[model samples]
Target: MLATIQKQQNNYVVKFTRPLSHSVDAVWAVLTENGKLQQWMSNLEMIDLQKNGKMHFNMNDGTDAFEEITITDYVYREVLEFDWGKDSVRFELTTTSDGSLLVLQETISELTNHTPKDLAGWHICLELLCDLLNGIVHDEFPMEQWRKWFVEYELLVEDVKND
Candidate 1:
């Protein structure tokens, strides 16, 4: 589903809420464990799993380069927030009666032409994460799906901006 976007004070907040038929622990592992994390988000790796710890964004450009991301907040299986450029990304998990609910929020300092691109990328990553949790895997990114989402997000962003 498309995430809800809103202008929050000086910044814009994009929030995606996903209800998954998996336990909180299972979903948490995929978000935190390097092995499982690679299945969905290959570039991000949790080098230190604590508040103020670090995660690395691998360049993946054949140059073993990486950008260090600081863990702004961490609370075991419940919350994880980290720096994302001038903004920040946060993941929160909660147990449901049947499974779990995952909330991903990205706080954008400013919306630019590239904002929709980042939102679409994140939308695809969440879809991939859901597939992995459901025992399905993809060897490569579904670029076709991303292209479709990018257009949708572009429109969505414009609507939010007008509001």
Candidate 2:
């Protein structure tokens, strides 16, 4: 499903919600554990997981350079929020009768041409994470799917701006 992008106060929030038929622990592992996280988000490595700790975002551009992302909030199996450049990305989990509901919200200080790209990238990542939890694995990142989502997010961003 496409994420809901809305302008809230001075910033924009792009939220993706997924209800998975897996335990909260399972989904939490996929979001934080290095092995499972790499399957979906290869560029991120959790260096220090506690609040005020750090995560490394590898450039992966052959220079071996990386940006240290700070963990702004942490609650075991419940919430994880971190700094994403100037913005912040948060993950919240809640248990349901069937399994769990995962909510990912990225707060953007300003909407730019690049905002849609980041939104689409995150859309793909969440989909990949859900698939992994369901025992589905893709050998490579699906660029085609990302491209499709990018166009949708572009339109959504425009609407938010017009509003």
Candidate 3:
């Protein structure tokens, strides 16, 4: 399944799930390593995939905007957990009848109100992942799509808050 944003538990959640023919090791390698991640995701550095390790992303303008990310839990080829600041996010992998199922859940913190931005970012990221797995090297930044989605998301959030 492609990544999507949902309202859950009074907060926003962004999730992606897919079944792949690749081995769990291969998937984990792509997700944990910096070079491999950049193949699909952004050019991110300072990512430590081990438990209690720190992970941060670099901005487009070469500035380091640090987030207090911690790898809270990890089990080889099975589960990975981390934090986006105080928010908890997890990646769970499971063996399915066909191949492997990968699920990513990003929980938004109540203190933050940037659900629209988060939704847009995740939509692009998941699209990139789909392209990467399919061996397509196309640029996956959906800037126009993100902007459109962000507007709708913000409107929805406002409607929910007022109800």
Candidate 4:
């Protein structure tokens, strides 16, 4: 499903919610554990994993690069928020009767042509994470999925601008 993007007082909020048939712990591993995280989002690596900790970042564009993204907040199996470049990304998990609800929110400081691309990336990442939790493994994110979502996000953001 496409994420909902809304403009706020100072920034834009893009949220993606997925109801998963997996325990919070199981899904949390995919969000935090290096092995599982690499499966979904390979650019991020949990370094310290605590509040004020760092998330090792790699451009993955062949510079053999290393950067640290500060962990703004952390609560095991509940909440994880971290600095993402100039903005931030957060994950919130809630238990449900079936499994759990994963809420991913990205704070956009300003809207740009790249807004849709960023939102689409999150959308794809969440879908891949859900698939992984359900025992469906994919060697990489399906580009077709990302391409489909990227266009949707672009239109959504354009509508916001028009309004």
Candidate 5:
């Protein structure tokens, strides 16, 4: 089972356990390389993989939406860190007895209305990544799941307002 979510410092930590039949290098390539990223993500561009390297991605939709991120730290096949505007995202990979344990820590500058949507999007993207890694063709996100989550998120917001 996946571990329960937790909040540490200014970031939310999500940890998952999976029996990845691939090597750590292979998994790292999928996460860092541009071609593999496009297979799972949408518009994608990456610079040299080094400290302060630049990474950019656009939403799949033709809305011209984009994110500019900077690599803060890089430890081959182990950990990667980046900054997206005011948010800092850290990706850590540990070799387990069976496979790899992946942990993502995302620190936001401030909690705002967009927090839930951002979290939901990341959750879906991570799932998509897993599917791609498992030899499944994941060219796009599952909109039905996104829609369901969005509706539930709206209801949560409404409930919060009433309280």
Candidate 6:
């Protein structure tokens, strides 16, 4: 499903809810493990796994450069939130009777043209995570899925503009 995008005073909040047939621990690993993490979000590398920790974003373009972002409000298996430029991205997981519910929320300090793009990227990342958890591994980024979500998210953001 498309994420719920809404305006909140000075910030624009984007939320994606995913119901997965896996334990919270299993889903948390996908969000935290380096191997599974690279599969979904190759750009981020977790340097520490605690409150006031660090997550580095690699340029991966050349030159071997990276930007460090601080992690805060972290809980071992329940929450993980980190700085994203002037904003923040948070992941929250709750165990269900049969599996788990994963909520991804991005707090955008300002609504810009790039907001939709970031939303689409996060949607695709979660999809990749879903596929990986189900043993449907892809050796590369899921551009096809990303392109599909981008179009849908663009429409979502446009609706926000109209409303």
TM-score of each: 0.99, 0.97, 0.76, 0.95, 0.77, 0.95
- Better structure of 1 and 6 per lDDT: 1
Overall lDDT per candidate, in order of appearance: 0.96, 0.94, 0.69, 0.89, 0.68, 0.89
- Clashes counted in candidate 3 amount to 0
Per residue, candidate 6 scores C-alpha lDDT tens digits across 9-118 of 88889999999999998999999988888887889888998999998999989878999999977998999999999999999999999899999999987767787788
Which regions of candidate 2 deviate over 4 angstroms? none
Query: Of the candidates shown, which would achieve the greatest TM-score relative to the real structure?
Result: 1
Model 4, range 54-106, lDDT digits (tens) per residue?
Answer: 99887788897988899999998999999988999999999999999999999
* lDDT-better candidate, 4 vs 5: 4
Q: Give the higher-TM-score candidate: 3 or 6.
A: 6
Where does candidate 4 have its weakest 10-residue lDDT segment? 132-141
Model 6: how far is 91 from its true place, Å? 0.2
| Model 6 steric clash pairs | none
Per-residue lDDT tens digits for candidate 5, residues 1-163, read: 2223445566544443444666677778777888886776666567668888888767756787777778999988888888856777777887777667677677666545775576566666667777888888764578888666656555554454454
Ranking by lDDT: 1, 2, 4, 6, 3, 5
Point out the worst 10-residue segment of candidate 5 by lDDT: 1-10
Return whichever of 1 and 6 wins on TM-score: 1
Q: Give the TM-score of candidate 5.
A: 0.77
Please write out the lDDT profile of model 2 over residues 76-146, one tens digit for every residue.
99999999999999999999999999999999999999999999999999999989998998889999999
> What TM-score does model 3 achieve against the real structure?
0.76
